[model samples]
Target chain A: MERPELPLPQLHAFVVLAEELHFGRAATRLGIAQPPLSQQIRRLEGKVGYDLFSREPGRIGLTPAGRELLPAARHALTHLALGLTAAREVGSGRAGRLRIGFAASLALTVLPSLLRTFRERFPAVDLDIQEMTTTPQLAALRERTIDIGLLREPPAHDAELGFETVLMEPFVAVLPASHLLAGQRAVRVEQLADCPFVLLPRAVGPPLYDQITGLCIAAGFTPQVTQHAVEWQTICALVGTGLGVSLAPESIRRIRLKGVAFRRIEPSTVRTRVAVAWRKNDPSPLVPGILAALNQGPPGRP
Target chain B: MERPELPLPQLHAFVVLAEELHFGRAATRLGIAQPPLSQQIRRLEGKVGYDLFSREPGRIGLTPAGRELLPAARHALTHLALGLTAAREVGSGRAGRLRIGFAASLALTVLPSLLRTFRERFPAVDLDIQEMTTTPQLAALRERTIDIGLLREPPAHDAELGFETVLMEPFVAVLPASHLLAGQRAVRVEQLADCPFVLLPRAVGPPLYDQITGLCIAAGFTPQVTQHAVEWQTICALVGTGLGVSLAPESIRRIRLKGVAFRRIEPSTVRTRVAVAWRKNDPSPLVPGILAALNQGPPGRP
Candidate 1:
């Protein structure tokens, strides 16, 4: 609603004049003529219903009201300045929070180094990190609960989302150290088709799970899933127990299980893709710099 | 120094428009026409070097910068309002501090009741009461260290200070309980001319000290001084010891020394004057209200 506003211009002038205590000097400092400066003071006094300054011959001084208004006026201006500075920082990408959701597996991949470089470049931007598999991450991005998503197998064409691949890794077979396939340096996707699979539930990462099952079918078999686990490390540990064989991205090799061996699959064209996903036409300025860091990564990485 | 100012009016318009997200409604709410409101937004966007609002067919929304500026704009306006309200309170007599310097002896007289009344009437006004005798009170008032003074024997005329009589008491003689004058109901000033006087040093309160000495001059004798003390209670104690006789304001009778007796002086025209003193042209709104309270003490007393 419209209401009476503080005479900000007049208060600004008053604070300056109160400091100078001389109308001529105050006018010069304010970049205005003396008459206008005096008029502004009179207007303020009229608005306040009191004489803010005592003008007597060559002597001039603040009235009690003027003294009271001075500090309060200064406080007002200071608060306004603080507000503007904060807004400017936010408007430019120098401040505010950015929440990111990523595939839990990416933490074993590019997530750490990418986040480190993002933080160093934009120390003022708050990063809220969440580990979500592809399915939940896509949902979080669409709902805007999360601003950026780092997940595998981002949808190729979606009306609401855009994606760019930041990492790609070949699928590898995981076998118990006592298994006969553990002696081979590489295995074929067709060879794994006969093994019971320790796979992630289809609901956890639908696209990646389907891609794996689709490859098995393409190799002339429907793979049997003996067990399901959410994390690659959990699947590898299950493999170490000789429960079943599992297929995982190359990055899962870093897990270092004592009783499991990782083997590259022959013809490694079927790759697990980690893409940076964001809502199409997202307004955050913080996203571009972060996306650049994710894409560039530390050089010599696939 | 002159610097770039946030176009406050434009930001104000922007915040309102951002809230409404409709130009016509926002303009009506701001009591401005739609085109001018749109112009203000455009001008603000120009100043901020970014579009504050995105205009699309059948849709309007705050751009990132607009969202950034909205809360900051509100904060700035709120602070300005706070400043104005504070100044308004001070401009009237509703708030601020009043430093009062008073004679320590006044605590036994009108000080407590007078201050209680003042506090009730101006509860928001801070009372900074400092104990000071007349001479120092006068000096403090001139230095503007204290806003008001309650002291005795204020000078008849001072160019820098103004005084109003608040309380008057006839001088009383303090004597040793065994002294011959202790049995008398009343004694004349001339009767004490030969007695050694126990009195406050002249430097402690020049006017009252001189008033006492001047009374002896008017009695046709120059009294010999025996003891000089700073406090009236100390003076009374020395008198109780039969060191010498003393004359003091009647309120000193409240001290109640068992060895001392207080008796009236004849021709009671010789009264100790306790006055309210302040700077002649004080600009504090608190002064006039406080002065009224000091002058109008509880009922009738000499």
Candidate 2:
């Protein structure tokens, strides 16, 4: 299809007029004179071969064609705004590319689905998915090198970014099949009060560590956290050897380990929430797609 | 921050050169002479106040600044392309609106998630989500009025649009809690072979309806379908009355009916797969966000 030639400034004027619905009000909004705004809208209408507004003296409203053009106009404006932002960021070499830093533990669970969905949806978008530790991911997001970070719990520096929970799963206790708890239909939180627990590393984030501690506290006693591992697999392996009982999300059921039995914990106290965190003022069209994919369950898991 | 003067032709040339790597190949790619391409790149470097390329006669490589500028260049080009497309589309009154024609049966499982995600991500994009039969969703997509469609398995016209599976869930049998089948750990497919079936209407699409028939055939008997309903709720209502057995996705667990009991079918034979269908050439950037959200499991379910 041949490209149409329309003055960009005239289109901008039309957008302001559409939003305000009055010539004088639109002129004021654009910080310009009313006569110039009216002239620009008329020129835009002439160039587009259609009347955008119905201006009958005292009454003014968007015509059918005007209403139809609103979304495209808004999209064009947004695209331009994003382009301007990218140019500035790129010129300074600060934040043009979106380096999506995620933890290795999420690769099998939520990360694959999120990446696949994001890639398929935004093929032109430059996404650098780096496997990093929670500390690096948080650090990168803070330094503005990474545009977004997907973490298991809310990041320690929540004040710098907007965080929204994308996935939440109740914790299931993994234990050796020969253990006494295996015979029970459901394991109570209080039953593990005195048992040795395999816990995530304190470096994962204090909030998550605190959450586990709170769960144990609610269970009537502090858990004897015997092992501190950085990844869930280590925790599961520890549980497999009858070393300790560990809590993990239900989605972790995809990982099969011999001698391990996963039982739903009664009065589910340990709920893990995965969230997407990005700088509050960072403007990127890719954020919406990333969030959408996360909301859609992880890809391969049933 | 002050807005920088970005030379459009130079940026365009630089992007083409970056993609092609070789000056001659870049010239060929942009349909111009090599001298012009080099000149444009030099001009672009001057405009941005930086040296973009490291040239050593036979070898061509990007400088750190050039590497940094690549994503922004691509982004700006994409936005420009979209802007031109939008301008053409709006000039013809076919640009901003997205006519989404969906199947009536899909309203229960897939349509809600698709609409919710699309609306949340692209609020400015006008959506005409019309609830129609499978035939109409296909017809609308072919006619170019609808940008996308949501329908059950085996889309009516596969050649017209690309179909991607958005959600898939096993069909469970709904019965009364006091029923003999409910007492068993899992209801076998053979147990429901002789039971009366409540089937979806034929208009929902033949392939999906046949999937149910095929499952029955696999179980060694043809189901005696005693009722036909257009929606899952209606079929579940019939099952609640002990009139017939009905099949529904795991999402149906959310729907509350006083007398209906959901039991997972062992050796599960039937699985419902919902897909999003769109025209192969549609260029809307917002489509990915909508697709991502739909691909994510429904909110709060996973």
Candidate 3:
């Protein structure tokens, strides 16, 4: 006879029977009534095409077939338990991968500490980090191509996305140290109204680009654009050459470029916020652990 | 919060949800109503200490935590399925061990074909073979030390023991080829009643010893036992030296001892029945496959 498929429940029952040997005892262990257990055994026997137990007047004994199934049943149950444990470990963020998309600016600021803390806490978790802008990063999150994104504050999109603001820093003016206003502790936005400014293009980061231009508009004059740079390092280099002044996040002061002076903006409300974004409804087990690691108790908060 | 232990049901549910992000679709896939599915998701979230799904007005999406859990859940389910397959394979005798005890006589008889067939059918099964007498073989079966036995028919034991007769061969008279009666095709048991005999002691094989002694008694004269030997080869060698004549199972003729000739007994009812013995109620999965390999189709029958 063709052997029928062995279901997990039946294998589990068989293992219990092999352990107890008595139907009443096994039934008690399984939390089921004796008759039902007996019926299940009968069904198992029908599938196996043999009697697994011999029914004598006073005692029940395992037939040869039943003895052979004992080890296998135990093995299967053990593996099932192992699988559950694996899932739990992955869910707890003690294991598995965390794919992250990061903006280039974070490398000099929060990135090192964040990565170090995550590594120390979840050593087994593999981090897949990709440098991406806010828009593409959010798009990647929506498409499920990435698990988490670290970027500057972004324009609002679908409410299904979640962004946790982790850092906020005041804008600062970067100028050549030899410039006439370099000695000032702080530069007012209106004082440099006619200054030719080196800045990033809107296509590079639309939200931050608009925030800088809006600050210029707020100062009563549209600054003449002299140079455009894709990154902070390039803008700092141009400013050191006395090309023009550029508004940058306070965290950018760490660069310490030669001949470049960083002075706080008079209206410091022109600041940048960095946030972590993800699909609000993502059911990934690793995300919570990653979020916990990313959390630094509201860094740079006012 | 400490990570709670993940249960199998919850992990299974997580796998389903990871496949279908929408609660309604996941609930349908799980064969439950949406509310209970939501409850299960809530329970999973409680265990994980985070949200797995974003609760938006219309669309469902995986939270970072949920995305992290997806692959782990899938792996766990796949492992569970693999474990079940392993159990089934073992239960069907395609894997595991078969412990067997056998009498020395079968080595030259049915053992070769039996082992070859068993190996061809179940290459992964480990065979544990021990050479033993019928009494000890039966004892091993009772003690659950061995799964199968190939031995001479033994005396009745407890009802829990089972015996299946596989080989039956009439006894034959073995004598020196140069002896007066060696030229004869057949020798009457009554004629050899007064001849000197070389036979194994009763302690070695009581059942066979009693049968041989009873045959002499039936022929009306007791054979004078001239020598004793522990093994069939020793007895055959003694008979070859013309020390005496002996009656042995017909399969023994295959030995072809020098200076010894085997002749059929006039009354062939004096036969040896070699059978496979096992515990009647042994529940071992390997027994059925071994039994099938041993059934050699009614040996020496009309």
Best-performing candidate as measured by DockQ: 1
For residues B16-110, what per-residue lDDT tens digits would candidate 1 score against the true structure? Answer: 88889999999999998999998998887777766667686566876566676677677666655665666678778888788999887777777
- Any residue pairs clashing in model 1, and if so which? none
- In model 3, the Cα lDDT at residue B256 comes to 76
lDDT of each: 0.81, 0.70, 0.76
* RMSD to truth, every model: 3.5, 32.1, 6.5
- The residue ranges of model 2 lying beyond 4 angstroms of the native Cα positions read A1-97, A155-157, A296-302, B1-302
TM-score of each: 0.87, 0.36, 0.69
Comparing chain B with the reference, what is the TM-score for each candidate?
Answer: 0.87, 0.61, 0.75
Give the range where candidate 3 chain B is weakest over 10 consecutive residues by summed lDDT: B1-10
Q: Residue A259 deviation, candidate 2, in Å?
A: 1.2
Error of 3 at B179 (Å): 4.4
Model 2, A108-146: lDDT tens per residue?
777777777767765656678887656677788878778
lDDT of 3 by residue, B141-183 (tens): 8888888888886666558677877877788888989888887
Candidate 2 C-alpha error for residue A300, in Å: 8.4
Q: Rank the candidates by lDDT, best first.
A: 1, 3, 2
Q: Largest TM-score belongs to which candidate? A: 1
